[model samples]
Target: MNWDKRYKQNDKPWDKGAATPVLCELLNIAPQYFHPNTTALVLGCGLGHDVAILHAAGMVTTGLDISETALQMAREAYPDLGETWLMDDLFNMNSNETHYDLIWEHTCYCAIPPKKRQDYVNSVFSLLKPGAYFIGVFFTDTGQPPQVGPPFSTTRDQVFHNFAKKFQLVWEGKPSQCYPGRENREWVMIWRKP
Candidate 1:
């Protein structure tokens, strides 16, 4: 998908204009899971809302996106946290560079083409420090055909197959809350790098 073009055209349907409801609820109910001053990276952080939420929770967060326009929008939306944004392809990030203590994923996994899902997992695994956490709110039942989309459909098995072996599963289940149409379609999972 031409993500930059989509952002340039303001065609982001996933741009919900606020932090994800599931993420907010997770942080609210389990603040102890996140340590203050720790580092975090938000993949496909379109408009920066979730990044802001992470920062507010005491994480030194960097919101990364493949689209410059999306990063621009994020900076405009949260000027005080302007420096928290980064523009780069998650898969292309140098594996030897700075690693993070936490990584947050929202729509990023679903947005990538299905063939690259394992690469996505590998890149995420490579980006974190040992014993760090990876928390994500994934679209497990998009109500679409498996062959269909940027917001592609995913199965429970696919999720576990890609991530469970390398990262120790800490928690997995339905999110406590979700966006209007997302009820029952999303799964919130937390994993720790072993």
Candidate 2:
């Protein structure tokens, strides 16, 4: 389904209504690494709760989602966030070279079609500065086929293998707690551009 329709109908089950606790915990643990003023980009930012968190922390934050409706709702809900909400596809992000220090990949990988997974990795690599990082959660569905998704089931091995050429998997582990339904199935990954 188109993302615009999903937002218009409020069909985004992926909207956790707040920033992912794993991301919050990571930032807290390594505040010096991901401090305020870091240039950050959040892909598939949905209603932008995490973007708001980044903005409040004083980062130069930009949020990109394909849906204009979602971006509008994000702006309305967080009027004071001062985030740059861009209506653009992640695969086609025309960002300048080495533009971001951090790329926050919440649910964008699983949301994309399986055939385009390589493109997703390439886009992330293209947007980040060398040695910059991508930090966030991903779902792993054991034995599930690629066609079964939006919250597609992905394996940790798949993610590592996909990014190995361009990124080094620096940190990875399951979170202490995930949002209601996503208990033990999520993996929080931190990948650095090499």
Candidate 3:
């Protein structure tokens, strides 16, 4: 795949160049969404936007991606924002020493193939401590044609169907801030791992 090349060539359109308001608000205003004791794991954390936001808010954050190129760029760009950065696929990751309190799902969900979404959900459950939180921001409706991907489309029902059994639905809504074109098309979700 051209996943690594996308960053090497600077061809990433999915990066809004900053953390979403859902993340920022949780850190800055909505303390109800997360606890200070929580450690965060940010999946597909290309370039550390949300990583920085979480770290700055005093949460221990780890940024993981499948691309070494992307991880290098993230470390180089924002060394102070992330507590740890790893190059690993979410599906294959395991940490015997640590279980996170909050898992941040940003671009990773939509980037993977639709059929593997359950794998993503399972990974999240395995990595989190019980009763922890999963904060997901999904692109509910994509205006792009079916052939266009990297950002695949999914609905609220799909998300609920995948996560509801293992995770208790805490809150679901729209993000307070999104990229320039993603205003109404996004779904901001919070679920607690049961």
Candidate 4:
């Protein structure tokens, strides 16, 4: 598969090897939103690290990725974490039409081609239950879009234009957590379904 080749070559520089610290902070800040019964979906959950975090938080979690190789690696790395990890196309996967309480997004938005961004937003909105949460860490572009893709850069305004119509902007700011050089390179965004 296209994505599987990257893992076969061990080329996933984007894998940080752990859940984003901002996700932990979100849980701490809004403990009420995450509970044992709460269902959370992690989109493009490459190595299932964030899925493990959600599992530890006592929420029913699922890790979905389009890459089977990534899913295999994640299952091996986090075998003890009880999570439902699946290989599915994000644009096609549905939560059995049940929707989720929270959608955890990290690096997924920036990875998609700009042309498909609208599709991404529509997919997320459709998969969330009314009044649910969509917490994400979006990669921001310092300037114009790059010539190559897969890690396309974006801005806050682009994000707002994409999902703000369907989801309410709850929080938007630079994240306190970063992995070394990524201090101000990404935007921590939270949106709620109205």
Could you give the C-alpha RMSD of every candidate to the true structure, in order shown? 1.0, 1.8, 1.8, 1.9
Ranking by lDDT, best first? Answer: 1, 4, 2, 3
Q: Report the lDDT of model 2 for residue 62.
A: 92
lDDT of 2 at 174: 86
Using lDDT as the measure, which candidate wins?
Answer: 1
Please list all clashing residue pairs in model 1, or write none if there are none.
none
Clashes, model 4: 0
Residue by residue across 1-194, what tens digits does model 1's lDDT show? 99999999999988888899988888878776678899999999999999998999999999999999999999999999958988899989965487999999999999999999988999999999999999988898888898799799788788998998689998999986888988899888899999
Ranking by TM-score: 1, 2, 4, 3
Candidate 2's TM-score: 0.93
Q: What is the C-alpha lDDT of each candidate?
A: 0.90, 0.83, 0.83, 0.85
Q: In model 1, what is the error at residue 182, expressed in angstroms?
A: 0.5
Report lDDT (Cα) of residue 111, candidate 2: 86
Return the clash pairs for model 4, or none: none
lDDT of 1: 0.90
Give every collision pair in model 3: none
Off by over 4 Å in 4: 142-144
Clashing pairs in 2: none
Global lDDT of model 4: 0.85
- The residue-by-residue lDDT of candidate 2 on 1-194, one tens digit each, is 59899899988878878987777776778675477888999999999988888887778899889999999999998998754898888888755453798999877888888788889999998989898998868888523676786768788888888888789888899888677767788888889998
